[model samples]
Target: MTLKDFLKPDKQANLEVFSVSPRLIPVNKSINFNLYINSSAREGVDRFVCIWKAGKAIQENDVSEIAKKFGHIYIAENQRNHFFKDLGDNKNLATKEKVEILKNAALDHLDQLFHNTDDMIQSESIKKCLVECEAAAIGLMESIRNYDLFGLHDLIAELDFHDHYTLDHSINTGLYNMMLFREINPNATNEQLKIAGLSGMFHDIGKIKLPNSIINATQDLEPEEYIKIKQHPIWGRDLLQQEGIKFQRNHLNIIKNVVYEHHENYDGSGYPNGLKAEEINIFARMTSISDFFDAITTKRSYHTPLEPLDALGVIENTCGIKVDPYLFERFKRKILKDEKLDSALYLPKDFDPCCPHTALDLMYEDEIQKSELNENDQEDVIHYHWAKKTQLPKIS
Candidate 1:
């Protein structure tokens, strides 16, 4: 008999037979939803199987006789669908709202996978997290494909502030890489974008293996400590290599290259193998630009955070030395354009005419000359110098 031959019409056919409860599904390998089928009708069981099959929802064909008898289908819920529905009014959400929803979902998934876990650096835990990371990356690319560059800029800026620097940094890197990837290759496919996002998110996974003291140290790291920290790329690459068994060959290659080569500089000055220019994978080069931008702009225990433009300026100076010059130019333009839009929308209408403090302000001669200025007075001097330099033109 054919698969459709099992259907038997009944009164319960019109009733709710197949249902999944607790709609929100966590990103994990475990079963997240309860599938129920009315025991009163055999048609309900057959109907459920047919619908699921038509949707191509179920990957495995083999089924237990007991489950088939009761019309129960056990399966992992689609993480992307669960995320979209949980954001509310998924059917009519605006593009911007969709982007926000996807961003939050990615962040939440990473937080659960990394923050709550014990010893995130463990090989088993890293492997599990990488699987979820790929899912989040795919979702991010889907949302980004429908979102404009301006909307993405706003979304990244809005979500940029987070207590967990590692997670936030990873998300931003992935996002920025996606944006840059689209610009570089306008015809890029969804799979390519997914690979780009995944590379950015997992680029720093090796850092988890480092000691907390080194990772979170407030003071300048000693040369010995710095040397230890430098091993993260090696650690990250090896970890991914071991975990690559589960991923397809293409995906494994992308993940491994990104983790291993992101730190390598354009001028052969970076760590690990110190590959130069085109020697490094293009995705790794893209990730490096995003990684450096996010790292300098975000607050850390060791140093004060630079403003976005100032951070860009720092990156600008190192173009061709630390990052790919051609790609950096594209990235710089994209960021500057977004910064202008952000300032227009968010800055107060009656904003002060004075310039804001920047990384350069710290080295202003006037501020440096102050002998015994109080902390407040010192700030005043820095701001005064900055305002006088140029009447705060919108960063172009």
Candidate 2:
């Protein structure tokens, strides 16, 4: 059964509910459970929480308290620790074990990405974080591409914008890297795909040097503020050189170009260095297309995210001027050729579905309703008339 089926409410429910274990059941169907905790003062709950314990029943409220204290809240039936342990330790089940490791790793990485904040970094710390993030992104890509790993869709669905621009950009870039990688070579080796994925994750690592105010700006800034933003590419190149990533000049050039030239224009009107057309690195050119696509499609602090088709239209409008003509053509062809890939570009209603996006959807719906109401108001006014001879009823 699917995850949606698993979350279905149980019938024959009891008010005096106790925890049930699904491991005891045979492999007949997928098991699902949801935790409910009472936090009302009259109900006398010190804390509202629930959790799963392997091979044991929750006897005391203290157990619940312990779970809550340790932050053991939601537990998935299929995500039991034993599953990971069994998958990790078994040699005969190498492929299955690898898939499990990769999936869990991806989920764990994403969890850190979504939940963690206030740990922003710039120099050495930023370097470490980028390395780990790249490792995870590349590893996940190789796992999914090679083994067709399970649980990826669910994991990807859980991605949200809680970790700020760095986190969101990392995940988005990694995802897009996988997309482009698959488009170019679905059967690529693990190493081949891994490097490409790493490139995606670290594409913007250089932007760490930018002033926080500019990076997190909510509205359009003055001309001077905009000029400072353009200096980020030079800052990025210097950062990479200091980090000693050790690659061919071409690869470094491409990556740095992406960092530097992502905002560059096709008609020779970008920033930092505005080398036109053939002068732009191919990787950066590819990134320019993907980065803008995600930027426009992703919900930002100041702008509503566009739908995929609308986003595509934006890309089309900028073609030959703002974006690489050849890359745009390639992107369009890929979208047209693959329905699934095209769908991936569009945000799914149930996926992520973060607070910001949920709020946007609600606001959009309300606006539509108000517009309809206004139209109806006009109709009512047009259809109504007051007669001077009308008589009023008297009440005694």
Candidate 3:
């Protein structure tokens, strides 16, 4: 490997490396693991340069000085286990640091389990990963209860994502699920948050049964193909049940429920069950919100990503129809408060991407949205235009 590969963090390779929140470090404490500061080389590659050696007593002034320059600190892969133990043992690790640790570790586990492995992940491997993820989820919940999760994304490290759509999207959905629940119900129990994270991560596991031709298809699918695609939820629910029995994990039931019902709409328009509002599971409702948000915002060979505000407008249009209205309102508040957006964003008056559920019309609209004709837009017309919908192939 090149020296740059060793120093610089790449989403594909350096997922082994985890980040530290500088703000979470207790001033004047002697940390067991070494800490590195982020540095950009002349060639524009990021380098993690070790600024503090292991077992050194960090001075308050020095800690503050480091925090001024870098919001994140780096821990090499070798120190990952030690760093996690430190976090578990220490009482001072707050919401921000726990988030950093949780995301970093999640990428590692998911990459190992689901990265190109179609021959069914082994049960032992699955258990080990779940046990680890469960621990991190509990710690994150404790921190959430203690310090609160406001201004969270800013304090956490820059996340490194997988190139594969499911891998990267799963991470975003999982995080969004946790954040949405916290915003909607700040009194969530530890078990509830743990379920939230795992359920979101594995929500689309049903799609693994589908062929790659369907998943990566740039053009529209045939009628038969679309019918086959819609059965992933059923397949996923069955798989989750089998694993739950074989592995004896009682909590997998909730995850299975979400897996089966994530696509069900609030207005009873979705498939598998067509269950309406209040009839759907709460976590599944939350998953739909995250699924809609992340699906529209991710760029693919077939679709371009949407801006945050524009995407928010699209979601607003579907608040009661496609998603739970109450949860959507809370999610909107959470996003606005977290992003600190003061000004309104422009959107198309007639644009709604979710209807007809056909690929050509939706894809055409995606291109149109990017065209010059739509100069300034303010979509979802609360009073302006009657913005209705858009729903792309929900990537597995």
Candidate 4:
């Protein structure tokens, strides 16, 4: 079934009167139900005093005092040990294990949020997701510092084949952007890296506002439908602006720019104002390349997935036209040199290596040859040429 089929209509049902428990007796007394008696009452003003009173009461209670009032006993007192002994054991976990734990937690939280998007408050959900993204970014930076690229790639690729396109694409884009940003500026601060990571993760938040019909379409879009699709960037930017008030000014700006300009091409051929070259925000420019790479490599309703090498070639070929040429070249070199992805070209276990040639294979024939040549050339032709021309720091 299509995604549209999964979304039930927004139904507003009245709260049914169920049997009330003794525990709810006091709680009901504390709340002023009279405030909600009027059906036309706006929650903001009508419930303000009631909510404030409840919040004030909560703030006045000390944790230990509340526990005592609730007749709870501390096991530590009877056992002659600390109450939270198990919590400290995590400190002994290896750094790699810690990073993996953090990465998995982040992805799980994101998956939950995406699945419950219709039921949760959007602003609150986005805020929590950003916090998780920042934590994951910090862990990722630590992993990169230790040169644990293989483990990192495996963790990311584990989520690569999931059926949820938007969630998987957001996560992979964030990861690819983080890696590329670190390579481009190895000396960048953790805060800067986190911003890049967060930008990539939320760049497509606007798509959440699009009709599922367009988003999940298996066929090509009509001209009007494509126009609606193009408006996603604008919607994303506005949504972030409205909900990101708590973010630091600079971080929020980075997010807004990335969402707004991620689709704009380097050659002024893109939509929502055809920003060209440096006119596009730098974070947006970086995210654009990563976004394109993830989009083409991931399977979607409209197209078959392309192999990593072939995907890179498509990005390389579109350099200066769709993406920043300089950035694309750097990103390409990094992927080709990454030892972690050495087996990236190998077909998955279910695939037949000798299967009939597909359209992608034919289109990427020349690019595939270049990759093979780079692999087999004793002189290291690609590296030699890159070193001779580019001003990049030497790849270790």
Q: For this target, which candidate reaches the highest lDDT against the unseen true structure?
A: 3
Candidate 1, residue 195: how far the Cα is off, in Å:
0.7
Off by over 4 Å in 2: 1-127, 143-158, 185-192, 243-254, 338-396
What would the per-residue lDDT of candidate 4 be over residues 1-396, giving only the tens digit for each residue? 232232232222242211211221122122212111112255443211111122111211232333333322111111111111111122334544544444554566566655565833377676666666665666555554533224445455554355656766776677777777877776877688778877887888777766667666655567787777788799888776774447677898889899999888776767689898889998898998777767656556545766666656555555566667677666556645653321223221112111111322323334444655555652433432332243332334
Considering only N, C-alpha and C atoms within 3 Å, which residue pairs clash in candidate 4?
A: none
Candidate 3 vs candidate 4: the lDDT winner is 3
Q: How high is each candidate's TM-score? A: 0.62, 0.52, 0.60, 0.58
| Residues 1-396, model 1: lDDT tens digits | 333443342322333232322222222122223233344355325332222222222222223332456445422333333333332323334545555555565667666645543643455555556666666666567556644444555567665355666767788788778877887677888678878887888787677666666665655567787777678788878877763356667887888899888888776768789798889998998998778766656555545666666656555545556667777666556546544311111111111101111222233233344622677556534433332232211222
TM-score of candidate 2 against the unseen true structure: 0.52
Give the clash count for each candidate. Answer: 0, 0, 11, 0
Candidate 2: lDDT of 298? 71
Alpha-carbon runs more than 4 Å astray in model 1: 1-75, 78-91, 94-125, 146-153, 160-162, 299-304, 333-396
Residue 352 lDDT (model 4): 13
The parts of candidate 4 lying over 4 Å away from their true place are: 1-122, 144-155, 160-162, 334-396
In candidate 2, what are the lDDT values of residues 12-84, reduced to their tens digit? Answer: 2223332322222212222233343323346343343333334432333433453444433333333333333
Regions more than 4 Å wrong, model 3: 1-104, 115-121, 136-158, 243-250, 334-396
Give lDDT per model, in order. 0.57, 0.47, 0.61, 0.54
* CA shift of 270, model 2, Å: 1.4
What's model 4's overall lDDT? 0.54
